[model samples]
Target: MDGTREMKDSKQLISNIQAQYPRLSKGQKLIAQYILSNYDKVAFMTACKLGETVGVSESTVVRFANALGYSGYPKLQDALQELIKNRLTTVQRVEMANEYSDDTTILNKVLKSDIDNIRGTLEEVDEKAFEEASNKLLNARKIYILGMRSSFTVAQYLGFYLDIILDSVHIIRMDMGDAFEQIVRINENDVVVAISFPRYSKKSFEVVSYAKEKGAHVISLTDSIFAPVASIADNVLLVKSNMASFVDSLVPALSISNALIISVGMKEKEEIKEHFDDLEKIWKMYSVYE
Candidate 1:
């Protein structure tokens, strides 16, 4: 099938599998059960390995994929990977952590995973999109930053420096009880910088969707193009966060945010210098630091 058709048919892979369960043969049902229960593992497994795990022949797996309307097992695997990319939970992550035993050097594995994630992010990031996002922030009349859960740290970090150097920067805080109320004032002249990673918050997606509907330009910092936020974003910055343990790696995400902030500051050097100079005087007046 073509890309468009594949996307339309496989919008919800698990749902599709369940919907067709009744018609599936006994061997296909075995493959389906293994996949539904251990998708994280199946996403990375080869057809041969999966066949061995499910006690089915490699041809059986391929037949099952064909029955699901995919070109082959690889296509089905890709759908599975996309489905779980940003939805893995903490409990699921801990289960993943348990896969490594006492003999495994988990610290090195995690560090290596972060290195690979950063390298992959750099490789896949669209330079044109990055430049466009930076320009939007630099030119916007106001900037609104949004993030929740683990992503909150990245949003807060970016917002802090932006607040220092730019005018009218707002960090949408859930603690305030009415994040939507705060963003109701956003309009076409504003920009929303939304951050989200695996186990993405429904609220963050809804808020970003609302911002897009309000005609605000949205700059998404997320794991992949398949991310829900990416669907509505005017500009997307892809950052990889794959890790071996339960915790998602933030090192690469933070690097992207840092680069964006630095780029925006470089574009407004004169304004940044003046703002910092005024802040320095206020700091001295109050003896804010030694």
Candidate 2:
């Protein structure tokens, strides 16, 4: 893709969840705003140095990429590289990199930027919307988890934790074809917690769309209001997780998932008890309970 197409793709990842992203923390929000405003710069930075410049840990950079539906920092960089290589002339790209050359001052600047982002996120988060989404998870008959690439980790985590609290939590982490096949089992009583961030993986969106079509309630975690999954989502939880770097972070997104899991745990404490009771028997049989 040309630079314009690449930039458009980057924008699409974040814009798709813009409305919901503001619920993230101040630092995470800072990262999100930075990515949007300085995407051209980020198309080239290494994850480690990117985190340093953004005043966040390297893990945060990796998490940020995960937040955006990338498997990790390298994948986000690939997307950035695609944008940079196809979008800008070599000379122009070089000129742009020189403009934001990493410096000690970047730390302070990134901190201030994140603070601003957090404030904005706080202002934009829809409390009632989040509550309604959580309620949906608590009441749903089956909870289906959809995520791919970077999002797969979050989906797996949610599925594992939610399973302890409720029965029938399904996670699709393999091929897109397999995911499509699994959603066929969804029904009116099922709810899908679908996660897709920047570079918003096409497969993730497809799964959400499929689940919705099957009459499953969909909850989305994405970066922007216009996130592709939002339109089909029954509820959306947004996380602001941009920073001045190449990678997108997942801390905020994971935090959102954790919150939902906690809510489910609270609502179905008895189910958790039964789930653990069965697990203990397996643990003893496997010598894990010694």
Candidate 3:
């Protein structure tokens, strides 16, 4: 179904604010105006900071988010961030980072944020979906993994280990030419693992669209349920990746990839031993490692 009907576009936030604008109190009106004028900036600001910047109380910002139908200020901020993620420039990202530069030491803050991301992801990840995706990988006739930009690293990591433990694994790369060229033979027996996070790559969505059209089983790993690829996926695994600075946080996503790899290995126990044994023989014969 592609979840298009269920998709929440940036328009939803804007329209919600506009629709309720006339009825808003003076304080809420200030927030609405500020958000409408400076969403990219506000996306990175905490509710308290946003309120202070606009000469309102912190509670006003919370109520304003609630009035717009968001569950809380963080959700509202997240929605705003989603709207700008794909469009934000490096300079804009750096500017946003400057807002919190003095909060704590860079090293400590970054590490703590990653810890929170993983902890949040662990709490929210759907167990049934993870198991189902694992089963698909185990049973697939052929497996194709796709990701672009920052996500490409994660795809490579997953593909590396899976190639050793499984048969017919293909990692899609668009470097030489069209990535589709590699997946041209994909069919119902094939499984496509698509990874994309905030500031998603359109190419990833294109690959998912093609896989779906060909009746391939599709599994998506993304930070949000509303992520574009989520609609078409047979199973969706959500990984938490709260924004911190100019760089996209991918540690949690990589951790999920590791979990997937280990799960597949556990299920097949003895089946993949011979594959590794033969590969080790080739490595030793060629002195691949000292």
Candidates' C-alpha lDDT: 0.86, 0.69, 0.85
Deviation from truth (RMSD, Å), model 1: 5.1
Which has the greatest TM-score?
3
Better of 2 and 3 by TM-score: 3
lDDT of 3 by residue, 26-91 (tens): 999999999999998898788999999999999999999878767678778767866777677777
lDDT of 2 at 289: 52
Candidate 2 ranges beyond 4 A from true positions: 1-123, 175-177, 277-290
Runs of candidate 3 with Cα error greater than 4 angstroms are 1-10, 100-104, 273-290
RMSD for all candidates, in order, please: 5.1, 12.5, 3.6
Error of 3 at 87 (Å): 2.3
Error of 1 at 18 (Å): 16
TM-scores of all candidate predictions against the true structure: 0.75, 0.60, 0.85
Instruction: Assess the local accuracy of residue 213 in candidate 3 as a C-alpha lDDT between 0 and 100.
Output: 100
User: What residue pairs clash in candidate 1, if any at all?
Assistant: 86-199
The positional error of residue 221 in candidate 2, measured at the CA in angstroms, is 0.7
